[model samples]
Target: MNTNSNLNYTQTGDYLLPNLTLNQPRKPLGKYGRLRRTYLKEQRPVLYHTMLLNGSLYPHLMEVEQTAENRMQQTMAQLLKQNPVPDKEQNQMAWVQHMNSLKAQAEELVLNELIYS
Candidate 1:
C-alpha cells in the first residue's frame, strides 16, 4: 500500500493559496467595511445610532434598513402601477418630477416610520 502515491502535487505558479484552514476562525471586516458602516451610521443616525448606543443592535440596524428599503420599493411599484406613465418625450419632464416627488415622500416615510420611531 503506497500511501504516498495517493497524495497529488502540483507545480507552484505565480499564485499560491494562503495557508488558511477551515477550522481557523475567519478575520473580521477590513478598514473599508468599517469605514462604510461608519458612513452609513452617520448618514442615518436615527436608525444606526442604536448600534453605537448598544453594540448588539448592529445586526438589528441592518435588518431595519432592509425592511425600510423593501417598503419603499413596494410603495414605488404600487404608485407606478396605479399611475402608468406615458412613454413620450413630451411627458418625460412630468415623469421625472413624479419620480422625484415619490422618492422624497418615501424617504420621509422611511425616516419617520423606521428610523425615528
Candidate 2:
C-alpha cells in the first residue's frame, strides 16, 4: 500500500530491494537453464523473508529460505570446483565481480518473487 516504503527504507522502515535492471551484467546469460534451477532452489528463503515482513509467519515458508540457501551454496561449490584459482596470482577483481554478480542475481530473484507474490 505504501509505495514510498517499498522504494526506500528511510520512508518504509524496511530496506528496499536492489535495483537489478540498473546494474545488469554486460554479458547476460544466453539461456535460463542454470539460472532457473538456481532460482527455483533459492526461492525458499526469499519467500520466507517476504512472508515474515508481511506479518504472516508460516513455518513452511522457512523451508523456502533454507532450500534456496542450500542450493546456492551447492552452486557456488560447483562453480569453484569447475574453476580453480591460482595460488600465487589471484584474480581479486574477477572474484569481486563474480561475487557482486551472484549477489545481484540473488537479490533480483528474491525481489521478483516478493513483487509477484
Candidate 3:
C-alpha cells in the first residue's frame, strides 16, 4: 500500500478571493471623475473648485439636513406635549396629517435657508 495515497495537491491561486471592507470611504470620483473635476476647476475656479477641494459643500448640506431633522423632532415633541391626544383611534388620521405638515414645514425651512445662504 502506498503511504501517499490520500495526499492531494491544488493550486492556491485558483481559490483566491478579493478582500473587501464595508467601511472603506470611496473616492469621490470614479470613471471620468478627474476630467470632470478639472473641467469644474477650470470653468468655475472660485466657487466650485474651492468648495470641492475644501470638502465643504457636501458636509454643509449634510449639516443642514441634520438640523432640519432635529428641529422637526423637537417641534413635534413640543406640539405633542402641549396638545395631548387622548383617543388614539379617533385622532390617528388627524395626528398623521399634523405630523406630515410639520415635517414639510421643517424641510421647506431647510431648503429656503440653503437657497438663500
Candidate 4:
C-alpha cells in the first residue's frame, strides 16, 4: 500500500501515479487563487514545483486566496470607515467613482501583501 495523506498511488511498471477518487469535494479556485497560481508558476517556479510534488500546491494557493480575500474585505471596510462615501442618490456618478477608487485601493494593498509577497 503506497499512500500520501489523502492520496493513494498505484505502481505500474516502474512509475507511480496517483489514484484520485471523487469522494472528496474541492472548491474550484477563484480570482485571487488563479492570480496567485500564475504568480507562483512564473515568478517562483522552484517553490511552486516543490509544493506541487508534495501535493500541497493547491491547498496552499487556496489558503493564500482566502487570506487575500479576507484581507481585502477588511481593508475595504477600513477605507470606507475612514473615508465614508457621499450620498448615492444626489450624486450617483461621484458616489460610484469614489466607491471604485476605494475598492481599487483595497485591492492593491491585498495584492501587494498577500499575492506578490
Candidate 5:
C-alpha cells in the first residue's frame, strides 16, 4: 500500500482504493446554502463535482450563505433608507408590504449574484 498526504489507501485485488471522508464539522446549512447546493448540483455539475472531490463544497456553501445573508441585510437597510416606508404605528399593513418587497428584492439580488452565479 502507498500513502501520501492526508489520503489512506486499501488494497484489494490489484487496485488501491483511496478512502474519502469529509473533515468538515456537521454544521446545519442555512437557506442560501441549500439553494446554492441545488443550483450547483443541477446547473453546474462539473464545478460541483470538483469542489466535492476537493473537500471544499461545504465550506464554500457556508461562505456563500453567510455572505448572502449579510448582503441581504445591507441591501434591505440601503433600500429602506432610500425609500422610507410609513410608520408601522400609522399603517401596519403598508409597512409590512414594503418590508416584504424589500426582502424579496434583496433575495433576488443574492440569488443572482451568489447562488446561481
Candidate 6:
C-alpha cells in the first residue's frame, strides 16, 4: 500500500508584517481567507491623508492651499534664479534639467514637512 500526502497552501497574509495595514482591498478575499492582499495595503498613506484632509484639515486650508505642482514650479524658479546658466551658449538643457530635479526635491521636502508637521 502506498499513500501520498500533499499540502497546498494559499498565502493569506502569512508573509505580511504583524502590524501591516491596508486602506482598500483591490478584490474581496472571498470566504476562504482572512488576510488582506499587499496591493491593497500599498495605498494606505493616500487614503489616510485623504481622510485627514477631509476630516479636520479641510476647513483650515479652505482658502490658501497651494497645489504640489505650483510649489515645485516655485522652487524651480528660485533655483534657476540663484544658479542661472553662464550664458546663452552654456548647456541650457542640462541646466534646466538640474533645476527641474531640484524642484522635485523641494516639492518632496514640502510634502514631507506638511505631512509630518
TM-score of each candidate?
0.50, 0.35, 0.44, 0.80, 0.86, 0.35
Residue-wise C-alpha lDDT for candidate 3, range 14-117, written one tens digit per residue: 65333322322243433223433454467656865466555664454444545655765776676667766446578888877776776666556644553334
Residue pairs with colliding backbones in model 5 are none
Sort by lDDT, best first: 5, 4, 1, 3, 2, 6
Q: Where does model 4 exceed 4 Å of error? A: 1-25
- Positional deviation of 56 in candidate 1, in angstroms? 1.7
lDDT of 5 by residue, 2-59 (tens): 6766778989899889877874647889999999999999999999999998889999
Worst 10 residues of 5 by lDDT: 18-27
Sequence-dependent TM-score of model 2: 0.35
Stretches > 4 Å off in candidate 5: 1-6, 11-16
- Which candidate tops lDDT? 5
Which 10 consecutive positions of candidate 2 have the poorest summed lDDT? 19-28
Per-residue lDDT tens digits of candidate 6, residues 44-116?
A: 5565466444453232232113343455567767777787654445777776677667766776665554332
For residues 13-97, write the lDDT of model 1, one tens digit per residue.
Answer: 8643333222211345433334445655778666555555545444554566567778789878877788776665888888788
The global Cα lDDT (0 to 1) of model 2 is 0.48
Q: What is the alpha-carbon RMSD of candidate 2 to the true structure?
A: 15.2
What RMSD, rounded to one decimal, does every model reach?
Answer: 12.2, 15.2, 15.0, 3.8, 2.2, 15.3
CA shift at 25, candidate 3, in angstroms? 6.5
| Local distance difference test scores for all models | 0.60, 0.48, 0.52, 0.86, 0.91, 0.45
CA error at residue 96 for candidate 4, angstroms: 0.7
lDDT of 5: 0.91
